[model samples]
Target: MGKITGFMEFERLEEGYRPVPERLKHYKEFVVRLTDEQAGVQGARCMDCGTPFCNSGCPVNNVIPDFNDLVYRQDWKDAFTVLDSTNNYPEFTGRICPAPCEAACTLNVNDDPVGIKSIEHAIADKAWEQGWVQPRIATIKTGKKVAVVGSGPAGMAAAQQLARAGHDVTLFEKNDRIGGLLRYGIPDFKLEKFQIDRRVEQMKAEGVTIRTGVMVGKLPKGSRVTNWAKETISPEELRAQFDAVVLTGGAEQSRDLPVPGRDLEGVHFAMEFLPQQNKVNAGDKVKGQIRADGKRVIVIGGGDTGSDCVGTSNRHGAKSVIQFELMPQPPEQENKELTWPYWPYKMRTSSSHEEGCEREFAIATKEFVGENGKLTGLKTVQVEWKDGKMAEVPGTEKVYEADLVLLAMGFVSPVATILEGFGVDRDNRGNAKATTDFDGGYATSVPGVFAAGDMRRGQSLVVWAIREGRQAARAVDEYLMGFSDLPR
Candidate 1:
């Protein structure tokens, strides 16, 4: 809208990355952000589509066109304002989100879409630099207390919103620090920890009480997932102490491959391996941390987590890194005609994949071959999908040597113990049972307990988690006061 023929005049310019060799030596963000001039040019490419499919395509329903127009006009502050209105953590999403909004851009039909994420990143960074992002403290204090269990994006969003709504909000985290997955699961090479720490400080300034190393419920014994909780508060205590409780602990149960040799010493879940590196990057001393140095590492699963493993392995100076995908390789390019205005299925090569990796698609592990309680290799076979069923190809069996195997399969659901502790019903998928209704949405079968984010919706993107958190905050506000003015 800022420039009528701007879309035709400017070609899409993507953000650059540091050289692979230089970046691999350290764990730090490598994305080169767009300069103001570059961002303005990218903003100019936003077509004034009537429908604005990108808004709907974004999980948080960001005002894309408004921000694009603001950027095009060089109104950086207003651009940040529009972006912050919808997304509580643009820095997080701008760095990691796959940018489905771009995929749904109208210009994508016949040309390269606008660089929306880069513009967002620029806006957020500029906002921070200009001191536009500051504490929004509530003037009036409601004589009510709320407990948010989990310090991930959903819990953080809910706590901030509720606190701003004049309610006393306490955020509990089991780990020693805030930011559930973002602080640990994601590699620093992609997202630096200081980004999360700055937000935590801002939340504190906003009057949200943060309690780290505190578990709201008991963790199952022998749980391998990370937990540094020094004290556990019973669910009954939370219900008795707080007016309401929001469960945003996220799905921590990592899916496992139950083939033989699963108990091998070298076999580990991606969670176990990832958190150690994050902790190390944070300058914490970890005992017996898992390392890929000089090891033939095999990462199973073809999702973001697997890609992360590949990157970390490369950083660890692994002997060789190989990734296995059970599904067939997707097309290099999606058919836009059939998939326009929606997320398209296509081959995605992450920065980690580009660094170095041997990717094997449509391969299934038959068995883990090991000796003396240690993994040595994997017996796999190529698989094909026929009639909606997977079958191994005849004479396709092969074995690959491996010194270590990391299971990067996605999570199945939240740990049942926490949900059961709260006496909340679970969906068929084992997530906490809760709805997103305006009147009483986010409320569980229990009267005062509620759920949101990955805990209620199963594993999902961070942007979706923030959306659920904000909507759930409004639901909780309405539940408390019989009405709410907070935006959903």
Candidate 2:
């Protein structure tokens, strides 16, 4: 719909990055965004298919075709409006989200899809540059008080929506800063803290009360999860103060490897390593920060988190870096016919991997070898899968040298004590037990309490978190008022 033959004329263009040597020196964002004309050309490639599977493919269900067409016409303001109608934080997703929308595009059936993510990035940056993103204050007051726990994307979206609907909303964060993982877990080079700062300012302008450094409930004693709360508010106090409560906290429990030498001094969780650098980058003095400089680093678990570890280690000037994955290597290209319009399985390489790293697939760590109470190396064996079970090859066992090790095996669930404090029911997987049914969606077993995002669905993408937050807000609005005008 953008142009009669635009799909046939233009090729998919990718966003650029700064040179590795130049970007490694600083912790600022290094992405080179596409120019207005390049973005328009990328938008012209959208086919505006009859079904538009990209809508459903995207977690927030963005109106992809309409926005793409508008971008092609150079109507950037209208494009931003269309984008804002569905997604609350395109800036976060445009930079980091694995764009399933592009995978589901009609053109992707045979050729490269439209550069939807880059176009989205352009539109969001353009809107902010032109001062179009401003606080939308409520004209009338509903006088209903709501409490939203966590300051992650989900809580942020829910708070913004409820504030727009005229509800008195108070967002609580345990961390000294507002953003939960976005503030600490994410590397600064990927997304700067200023993005979160501007959004917080806008939320304050819209009458949302933000309370940082305050914990709603207690965490388990000796818990490793990051917390900077200087004050504690019991769950009873929160429930008595607010008419409705929404728990949108992230899944923070990191999965651990219970192998020998697990307690070695040099072995640490990914969370412990990543957050320290972010604090230092924010100008906070972190005493005895984790340093990978001149150390041999072995990162276990091959995922985005592991990739992040690789990038950070390289920045710290590590002597060497190696990554391990338990599963066998996938084909470089996916079988499109089998996985059309859905996420496909294939070999993937991140920019960090390009910087420097050795990748070992179908390998499992058997034991961590250490001396002087510090990690020195690890013993591993090659593994093969048969009938959905893994078997280690006997003769392939070997030891690799390492002075530092990072476990980036991903999160298991939200911290247990927070849920236990409120007496909310949990599912088999240890997530909040709540259905997404149209009637009483997101409502917990405890009356007046609800859960969404990682608190309900376990760990997932930021876009998915935003979707849950928006839908949960609608559910809360309907519970407060007989009907909700909010979009799901």
Candidate 3:
């Protein structure tokens, strides 16, 4: 508590963004960061409540109050130390996380919450500038080999942790580079590839072997999810070569819109369209890439992915961009009294949404209307909830012209073939079946095999992925040495 009265004296100030006109012309990060002094002021606004719900609200259980106090006192190094203790990738979370911690902030109940995410961003950037972010090499070698399949946040965190614990860790990725989704799934306007490259360099310096363009197991035939694997190693070979294997591959099976004319040309899955642009941004030439230029684009599904499509389409100079949500629009703000200390349902206008978009809520697509195998328009109807069931309005059926349709529905589960190759049991939801308990947690039905992140819990936030990775690392460590000294 650097300043007990600071919360009463200060109002919340969010980070700024570049002007939309200027930012829309390029595919780079546009959000302006908080200066050191601004971060200090924001940190001082923390009330340092007895419960400190922001800590629990954060997926990685960061010591929020301690970092806030440290930042408020101008102890920047200590602030980074506290933040890095819980989160291995604070930069990623600071940039992209929805900040559920803010929703659970004690001050949020009666006033604006402290700008914790902005302060975190400032601290992480400052730490990097000051050369405080360096490789932490283990002192002793354990003579144990651990194989981590997938180079996303979870796999990276687990590989780093296991390497620091003196185990020989090898990380495998199917893509030509590291960072499973971060490198390709996310747009460069949100997160640049250099951030991932910097961390990859650090991980390599920490003695972790990173193998790219190598798939750990076979993908199902005709699967469309991104994969540049020129070589595939059998699961049995991995189990035989490594002391333990950790599965951190993310859920890649996108949920499809199986309606009439789904097979029409110019209609594509969000993954199919988004990754091409990302590849182009990385200076790779893509053949017959999906373009939105001068086209009437309709993005189905209302979520982050859909919002991303909106942004990318705008960048592509699409003629018009429209987004549809089947659910009713939420309130602009949540009732804090009723939803305090938990993630609340409220209308969230992302930076992408603010750029430009026509949002339609309580709407459902009836069928994709096409002519001669190319998409032309779609038939839709307004819907209403009656007794918690969806019912289409009788007279609200309408048609809208469209040149391209991007289905941004979220992913369903991990690719089935990889899970099947390892013989890992699956949950009812089709995710890898594994527990998060302290005793033998993250262990699959098969011995010496583990699962974490999206592979175990289905698609979720990056912060959640890091949390699971750290916890799974501790579990794997315990399994290896009969006990673990690593933090969970």
Candidate 4:
């Protein structure tokens, strides 16, 4: 987009991260950003194709070519403007999103895709460095109030948009901090807490009231913030107090393996293990911190959550880490022509795997064996997929030594407590039920109540959550004021 022959002339270059040996010592972000000159060269690799599939691939539909052109010219401020116009938090997506945009890049049909994510990262970082990133206080008060539940990317985006549209927005969270999964579920090695903190600060400055440590409806003992209000507010109170309500509470119900020794001490959910380490990294004094040091960790899942456990256990100096997946291994290389502008089925070995991990595919845990209420090992069996179902192979059972068994199996649906607490209709998959069609989009069966993000649409990427949040804001605004200028 920068030069007529730019794509042909320049080779793509990506930002470098620190060496794993050095980075494994601590949990700080190890990613090395591209220099302005390097980023400019990468930007020049954009072909500006007749149709940019990157736009369709990106959940928020970012103007990839325009931003690439602006970065090539070193107009970082404008780049951020263009990026922020679509994405509410480029910083989050820049770090953790799978970047379907890159997979859908036209350049990938032949060679490596243009470094779109890195460029977006560079633009956002430069904007903040130059203090160009600022809160947009509403110019006029709309005199309407809105209650947004949860402070994850979705809730944050919805709150910011509604506030910018002059709504008195109050974002509530049960946790002591602001972010939902971004605060706790995500390990610090991938994304530091300060990233969430910085964005939360901006949201606050933009006229959004972030009320943390305040659980809606009923909370079990020890769930309340010690310094905040003591009692839980009913859903009826919230509806009465606010002009509209948006439920962005994330899907947090972790799927568990109901095998023998499921209730053992060392056997834990990924959420239980991941959150404790994150809290410790944030300087909290956890009484019994989850540690994998000198322990054989058997992580039962092969997705991002399992990879995170591998990385965390490596950082904890674990004796060994083994990951198991129920599905058979995918082909390493996809049929490029067949999968060319779409996400293809292929095995993805993460950076954590690079650190150290024994990956076992098509393996399912059969039973957890333990002594004295503590998990010690697990029995697994290899299976093959046939006729759209898995069939266990005869004589495929094996015992894997495990001092700690982390069920990294993905979440099933939104945690029922809060969703049920609000009495909202749910889909068959247990997510909040809502439609995205223009007429009453995001509106739940409950009047004046809306749902979006993982809570509404199962677990997904941060970028999708942001998109849902922004669109849901427009829906809420329209429901309140009869029309909304907020971008969908």
Please report how far candidate 1 places residue 460 from its true position, in Å.
0.6
Off by over 4 Å in 2: none
Q: Which lDDT tens digits does candidate 3 get at residues 443-474?
A: 99999999999999999988899999999999
The CA lDDT at 414 in model 2 is 94
Tell me how far the alpha carbon of residue 356 in candidate 4 is from the true structure, in angstroms, after superposition: 1.1
Candidate 4 clashes: the total is 0
Give a tens-digit lDDT track for model 1, residues 1-488.
Answer: 64778899999999999999999999999999999999999999888778999999999999999999999999999999999999999999999888999999999997888899999999999999999999999999988999999989999999999999999999999999999899989999989999999999999998999999998888889987789999889999999999999999889999999997788889999999999999998889999999999999999999999999999999999999999999999999999999998899999999999999999999999899888888899999999999999999999999999999999999999988999998999999999998887668999999989899999999898889899999889988988988898999
**Model 3: ten consecutive residues of lowest lDDT:** 177-186
- Looking at model 4, the pairs that clash are none
- Alpha-carbon error at 230 in model 2, in Å? 0.6
* Candidate 1: 10-residue stretch with minimal lDDT: 1-10
Q: Write down the TM-score for model 1.
A: 0.99
Q: How accurate is candidate 1 locally (lDDT)?
A: 0.93
228-280, model 2: which lDDT tens digit per residue?
89999998999999999999999999999999989988999999999999999
Clashes of 1: 0
Q: Give lDDT per model, in order.
A: 0.93, 0.93, 0.93, 0.88
Off by over 4 Å in 1: none
